[model samples]
Every structure is written in structure tokens, then in C-alpha cells.
Target chain A: METLERLLLGHPFFTDLDPAIGRILVGCARNLRFAPGEFLFRENEPANEFFLVREGNVALELHVPGRPPLVIGTLGAGEIVGASWLVPPYRWNFDARAVAATRAFGIDAACLRDKCEADHHLGYEMMKRLLPVMVGRMQAARQQLLDVYGHPGT
Target chain B: MNASVAPDPMLPQPWRVQAVRRETADVVSLDLVPLAGAPMPFKPGQFNMLYAFGIGEVPVSLSGDPADASRFVHTVRAVGAVSGAIAAATPGTVLGLRGPFGSAWPVAAAAGHDILIIAGGLGLAPLRPAIYHVLANSERFGRIAVLYGSRGPAELLFHDELARWRGRLDMEVEITVDHADPSWHGRVGVVPGLIDKVAFDPKNTVALVCGPEVMIRFTVAGLRAAGVADDHVHVSMERNMKCAVGLCGHCQFGPDFVCKDGAVLAYDRIAARLAAREI
Candidate 1:
């Protein structure tokens, strides 16, 4: 529907996208809702889908032997989840669980990939938009790794 | 400086520890009452030099409500010998106290503007008094938000108080941790990461930041990126403090002694000092 297309275009990932490219992306996107505690995708599973969160929160987690899953990061409204879909071997690296009743637009990765392959401009645009998100997360993760809070000396 | 403080600032007055509450495995909050004279009234960002008998003295920020005249509350982490002795003291233990030192948070100047309080790790301990004052006088400010980040859930200070603040409708409180176990349903990320989640008019907002030096650097950068001017951002700096009075150069930060010029200072005043490697 045109309403869904417009809503999808408003997402940061799709914002400023050419109308033709947006329409192509909307074709592969569908509305999704998850109950609290529902797992959107599991680690080691095929990363066939990615999402643009419209409302609510999602936690990306990792499970360890004999331990509860550790939350790596949380994504909220207006943020994108699941960049693994863009890389080769197409598999999830962590489990994403809806921390609250959530609504999102799930985009089929294979469908978008085929479109990108057919049109280099669309592929270039997608890379241009997603790279920043990846770099931001990487930098934040690095800061966390520094354990800035627990340094022994003042 | 408080008017009631002893005229001889160098002399330590005896104060009795009224009670001790364990904040974490390594941190404790000591409620102290002056045994001789009136309790020294401290502004939100000021600190006290607490002497643990034969061991030594350490400068601790005032964490209690400013309105509470009966006792002074200090939350101390057992980082070294003197702090460990203070943290291990039981109720009724007598400790020597001096001060109510350093510049206070610019709560008056911050009126009519939004307030953003960013605290990381034990930095939350020093900022708690300022938060108490702001909440007690909430009508003077615009939107208010508190963003706190710790190493994890168990390391969080003031569990019940943080929950109460979160429940209030007037202000926003977002908490995050650098890491967490599987049971944590909250956010897991660096403190600066939460800045994007909250709403504030950056140009008209005043930011108060405290934490490790490295964390403060990153947080100030985040605020700058978010459009806040350097002058509007205030930071609490920690340094080696020996004499609570400005006479001892132990607390020197850049050209100013943190004991007198700050513990709380406008970020613009020290932006060059902070950026310099030699400082």
C-alpha cells in the first residue's frame, strides 16, 4: 500500500532514497509485530530478514553455556536491526528478542539483494546508508570494551 | 564554603558515623553527624576531606540532600588504603572531617533551561546531591533528564532511588550498562549512547557530567556533537587532593587547583587543558 511505502521511506535507513528505489524496497518489506519476549531471529539461523523498528524495543543477545543470554545492545524505535543480512553466508550472529510489544517493517534480504545486484545505484545507496550505522555500532562497542567505568585507578 | 564550618579550615573536627549502608560490594554510604559543632552545610558539588584516624584522609563528594542539616552523607568506594578503612568503618566510628570545599554546580545559572545529567559508574555518587536539589525545585527548569551508565546491574548505586526517579512523570531517566548478564532486560551500551535516545533543546540545555576521566571526555564529545555549547556543559574533575584548602598543590588541574577553582567547572574553561596531553 502507498501508506506502507511512505512509512518505510520515512525510516532513517530509507530516508532520502529515490522514489523508484523506495518502491522497490517496499515491495520486499512487510509489517511485523512481536509480543514481549518473542524472538525475532536466533543466532546461527539464516539472516533472511532485517527490520526497521517503528515502535518498541529489541535486544540483541548472546547465549553462553550454563548461563543466561547476555544483552549485547538494545535497539529502539527509529533504529535498524540485523545488518548481518548484508554480508555473505547470511547468518545471524546473535538472537534478537522483542523487549516490549513491538511493531516493525521486516524486509526480505534475498529480495532486496537481487534488486541491488540488478541495479548498482540502489546497491551503492544501500551501502552508503548502512555503513554509517555499522560504524557507529562498532565504535560504541569499542568504547564499551574499554570498561571505562571499572578502571582500577582514578 | 559553609558559614557553620570551623574557622580553622586546616583543623579536622570529630564526626561520628551514624550508620553505614553498603551500596555495592566495594562501595558504602556513611551517614555522619558532627560530634562537636554544627554540621557543615555543603552545596551540591562540594566535597569533604574525611580522615580515617591513623590511616589517612580522602576527599569525598557530598552525596546527601542539601536540605538535610542533621547529617552529612558520603558514598565512598574502597579503591585504596584510606578509602578502604573509611568504607570498612562501623557505625559510631569517629572520623575527622573538614570542608564543604570546591565550586558548586551552577544550579542558579541553569534556571530557565533544560538540564541533562550524565553520570557514569561511581560518578553517580558525586551527582546525587545535585539531582536531589533539582528534583526538589523542579519548577525552575525546563525538561530534565538523567542518563546513568554503570558497568552492569549489580554495580548500580541507589537502587530504590533510581526506581523512584524512573517512576516520576516530570523527568526522564534512562539507564544503561557497558555490559550485562542474560537476565538484564535493560539497555547495554556506553553512557554516551543514551544521549541520542532522550530529547532536549541542546542550545538551551545545561549538561552536568562526572565519571572516569576517559568517560567524561567521550560524554563531552557526545554533547558537542549533539549541538550543546562547551560553556553550557559542566564537568566534575577528580585529582589528587591532599589539603582541602587550596594551599596544597596536590589537586592542581591545569592552571587551577581543583580544590578551589572546581570539582565542578564549565567545560569551556578547561577545554584546552583537557585536550592537552601534558596536563
Candidate 2:
């Protein structure tokens, strides 16, 4: 749809100057929704999809061996959700659950990856943009490990 | 480094806990009033050594409005033995308070410039008084943008106050939690991630950061990359403290003592020192 192409190109992350490239990206973008408490992806699953949040929050959680799942971070509107797909061993590192009824522009990572390889320029641009997201997530994870909030008990 | 002008910075005065309000699951804000003599008032970004009856003492920054000298405030997280004891104490309980010490945030010097306040976890408490000063004198400062982040939605402090600040036309308040549950409808991510969403004149901005040292490091880097000068940025540093005065050298950060020289200092002053955690 023309509107879909417009929306995809309008995203801050996807300010494609080339119309042909925009069309190719729009081809992989699908409008997807997740119900409250529904998972978009589970940990260790194939990381074949990435999302541009358009409506609600998604909690990215990791399961502990003897404890309940620990949510490492959450993603909301105007933010990109999955970065594991960009790296090899393309597997979801954490379970992403819909915090509320959520709407997003989901891009099938497998299809996108194939296209990016076919066009190295686009691949480089895409990687350049996604690098910050990956680094931000890593830094956030490191901060959590520091337990900056301090423990509740003495 | 702004040294204390107190008559005797070492003496502990009895300060009564007038009220205590729970800010989060693990933190509480205590409103304290001196039992007898009125010591020197606290400046924004300054801290007091709060001594729980027989427990011990820990430096806590004043979290109240600096303009209201009647009762000072300190938000305490139950991080260790002494801090936990203070957080658990009753309203009528009396504690030993000493030295409203440390360098103040550049609230006075930052006039006519945009203020970008970035905080994380319990760091917001130290910056809260500085925020109040700006809000109280709205015309003196340009834009006031505050970005705060927590471990999770349940860990966020000052929910109601955050809403009120966000409601103000003069202040721009945005908060993010590292993680969230279904009930949370706000932004999610680290504190630094929210930097791109707000608008401020980078060249004319005076940034104040209070967070985990790593968060502060990253934030300072990001702000500098975005055009803020090293000297224009300030950070409230946290180090272990024994004596509220400079005599015990327990809270030394590189060349300076945190209690006397600064708990708050310009980023450029100790940028290299902060990079080395053990120093």
C-alpha cells in the first residue's frame, strides 16, 4: 500500500532517500499485532523477525535457572525491538511479550537479510543504524548487572 | 569544589524525622527537622551525614526544595545497614545529622541556559532539589528537560511528582524503565536512550547527570557528542564516606575528597578519575 510505504519511510530509523530501496524495505514490512500477554517471540527461537513498535509496550525477558523470568528491558512506539537477527546465531536471546495490545511493523529478518546481502550499500546503512540499538541494549544490560538500585535488604 | 562554610562541620546535631514517605519498594524519603539549633541550610546537590540512633551514618543528599529551609529531605534506599536503619525508623525517631557539605549543582551559574537533567535509579533524589530550584524560578532558566530511568516500572520513584512535572509547560519530564509489565504504558529502555527524544540547545545547555557511574559516563559522552561542552556538564558522584568532614579521607575520588571538595563537580574536572572505578 502507498500509505504503508509512506509510514515505513517516515520512521526516523528508515529515512531512505532512494524510492527503489524504500519499496524493497516496504515489501518486508508487515502489520502485526500481539494480544495482551502474548509473546511475539520466545527465547532461543529463530530470530527471523524484527519490529518497529507503533502502538504499545513489549517486555523482553530472560528466564533464570531457579527464579522467575527477569525482564531486561522493554520497547515502545517509535522504537526498534529486535537486534539479535542482525547478528549471527540468529536466535532470540530473550522472550518478548506484549505488555499490552500492541501494533507494530514487523520485518521478516530472513527476507531482509537476503535482500541486504544482494545490495551491500543497503546492508551497510542498515547495520550502521542498528548498531546503536544493539549497543544501547548491551549497555543497559551491563547497568542492570551493576544493580545500581542497590538491594532491598542489608 | 565548593567547601563548607559551617562553624564546625564535625559536630553532629540531633535532627528529628518529621515524616517519612515511601517512594518506591526499596526507598523512602524522610523529612527532617533539627531538634534545637538551626544549622546552615543545605544547598541543592549538598548531602548530610544521617546517623540512625545506634546504627551508623551515611551521606544522603537533600531531596527537598532548597527554598523551604524549615524541613530538609533525604530519600534513602535500603542499600546497607545504616541506610536501611534510617529508612525503617519511625517519624518521631531522632537521628544525628552533620555537615550539609559538598559542592552544589550549577543551578545559579546555569542561568539563561537550558537545563538537561538526566538521572537513574536512586540518583534522582540527589537531583530533585536542583530541579525544584529551576521550577521555582522558571523565568531564570530556558528549557528544563529531565530524563529518568529505573531498573523496572516497580522501581521508579516520584511517580506522582513526575506526572506533575510533565504537566508543567516550563519543564519537560520523560521517564523510562529498563523493563516493564503489562500495566506500564510509558517508554522502556535505559536513561541515555531518552536523550534523542528531547530538544535543547546543545551549545546553550547546562547538563546535570546523576546515575550509576557507568550511566553517567555514557550520558556524558552522549551529551558531549551532541555538542555540550565538558565544563558545561556536571555530575553528582557517589563514593564511600566515613566522616562528613574532609579529615577522614575515606571518600577520596582522585585528587579530591568527595565530602569536602565535591559530591557534585563538573565532568571535565574528574572525567579521567571517573573512568578508573577504583580511584
Among these predictions, the greatest TM-score belongs to: 1
Tens digits of per-residue lDDT, candidate 2, A1-154, equal: 8999888877767865477888888888888989988999999999999899888878887877876676667777778888889889999988999888999998999889999999998788788889877776787677667665555332
Give me the candidate number with maximum DockQ: 1
RMSD to truth, every model? 1.8, 3.3
Worst 10 residues of 1 chain B by lDDT: B1-10
User: Model 2, range B20-113, lDDT digits (tens) per residue?
Assistant: 9999877899988888865467788999988986788889998999888689899998878898899997799999888788899989899999
Docking class of 2: acceptable
Off by over 4 Å in 2: A1-3, A16-20, A30-48, A54-56, A61-70, A84-103, A152-154, B1-6, B53-55
* Deviating ranges (above 4 Å) for candidate 1: A15-18, A151-154, B1-5
Global lDDT for candidate 2?
0.84
Instruction: Kindly provide the TM-score of model 2 when superposed on the true structure, using C-alpha atoms.
Output: 0.86
| CAPRI band for model 1 | medium
